[model samples]
Target: MRIALAQTEPLWEAKQENFRRAERFLKEAKEQQAELILFPEMSMTGFSMHPEKIGETEEEPETLNYFAKKAVEYGLYIGMGYVEYREPKSYNRYAIISPKGGVLTDYRKIHPFTFGTESVHYTGGDALGFCKIGDWTVSPFICYDLRFPEIFQLASPQVELIVVPANWPEDRVEHFKTLLKARAIENQCYIAGINRVGHARTSVYSGDSMIVDPLGRELAHGGREEELLVADLDLEMVWKYRAAFPAKIDRKPELYRKLADGMQI
Candidate 1:
């Protein structure tokens, strides 16, 4: 499958303008023959904690509908993040839409960035989202979830590709790159991380979007500029490598139960 990461600079609290930009990017991705396109976390409204201003309920998700229309028009799968409001609480969520304008998945972020006080603003998700896309088993995860390897390990057995939409700051870009490659190497699955560029409030993002193959080879990468990074992934390569090496099969889950027993340093 051919994937395109839309490394865009979302205007803070400006949904319409961002939606316009996203449409242009989607058109470009379609022209490039990309089957799927990914945008960064909080795609329309940069990374803002003020959910009251940007959050949308599932019943009235204009942002999601906008992308769904674009997906159908462009004949490509679209994945974008937003703040989801569900009754009394809100969650950091990513939604996937098919080419026919159907909603494929709505994945709430499992791990909120506590250091950034995201936990205070949004609730963490109770479940992971996984779906079969083409020849690959695909999973969608949010920004802070990349720091937790256990979640990746749990999905690794069934997932062939993992997509992360992040609003990571420029200061911690090295950690982002390191963790992305680590996840790909450990799980033997392709990983695509799409981050934003430009400034959001006081924080600045460099947009180090990248696509890594199952073997930890970077197929495509983006720098500080707002652009699209595209790469073609082969599902056969994932199965071939896993069948030959079989590293995940060697994991001793029972022996590692102590990891959940809260051992302290």
Candidate 2:
């Protein structure tokens, strides 16, 4: 499938401007003949703690329906981040919109950044999300979730591709790249990470969005500018690699369960 990652330089907590920027990017991605378009972390609101600022409905709200409708109109699948309302609280969420403008799934950010007020403003989702789009079984994750490999492992051999939407800091560019490659190599799946650019509230993001093949090779990467990282990948490659070097099959799940149950690593 042809995948496009829009590494956006977002407007700090400004909802409308962010949407305008994303709409332009989506149009360009569609023009490029992309089947699926991915956006950076919190593409709509610039990754902030002011949950009270975002509204519930589509009008004055963050207006996710706008993107949904655009997806249908353009006949493209879109995966973008926003703060979704959940009555008394809100959650950092990714909306995977189908080509027909329908919501395929809404994956909430399971791992909240405790260093910021993310823990204060949002609650975590109970389950890790995995879904099928066309022929690909894909998984979605947010920024800090990259540190935990088990979440991706839970998806197992089912997920052929994993997408991470991150607001990673500029100083830790190496760590961000390291984990992206590690996730692809260890999971034996294709990985596409979209990170934002520019500074927001004293935190400058390193915009190194990329697409990695099953062999842990980066096919496409973005710079510290608002741009689209595009690449074509084969879904069958995951099975091809793992079958030749069946490491996951050789895993000692029985003993590992004990280690995962809090025994020292």
Q: Candidate 1 residues 104-182, lDDT tens each?
A: 8889999989999888888899898987667777899998999999999998898899999999999999999999999
Query: Model 2, range 1-265, lDDT digits (tens) per residue?
Result: 9999999888887877777778888888889899999988788778878777763444543456878888888889999888876667688888788888777777888888888768878888878777678998888999888988988888757789999999999898899999999999989999999999998998988798889988899999889888888888887777778889898977787888887898665
lDDT of all predictions: 0.91, 0.84
What global local distance difference test value does model 2 have? 0.84
Q: How does candidate 1 fare on TM-score?
A: 0.97
In model 1, the runs with Cα more than 4 Å from the true position are 262-265
Give TM-scores for every candidate, taking all chains together and pairing residue i with residue i. Answer: 0.97, 0.93
For residue 94, what is the lDDT in candidate 1?
92
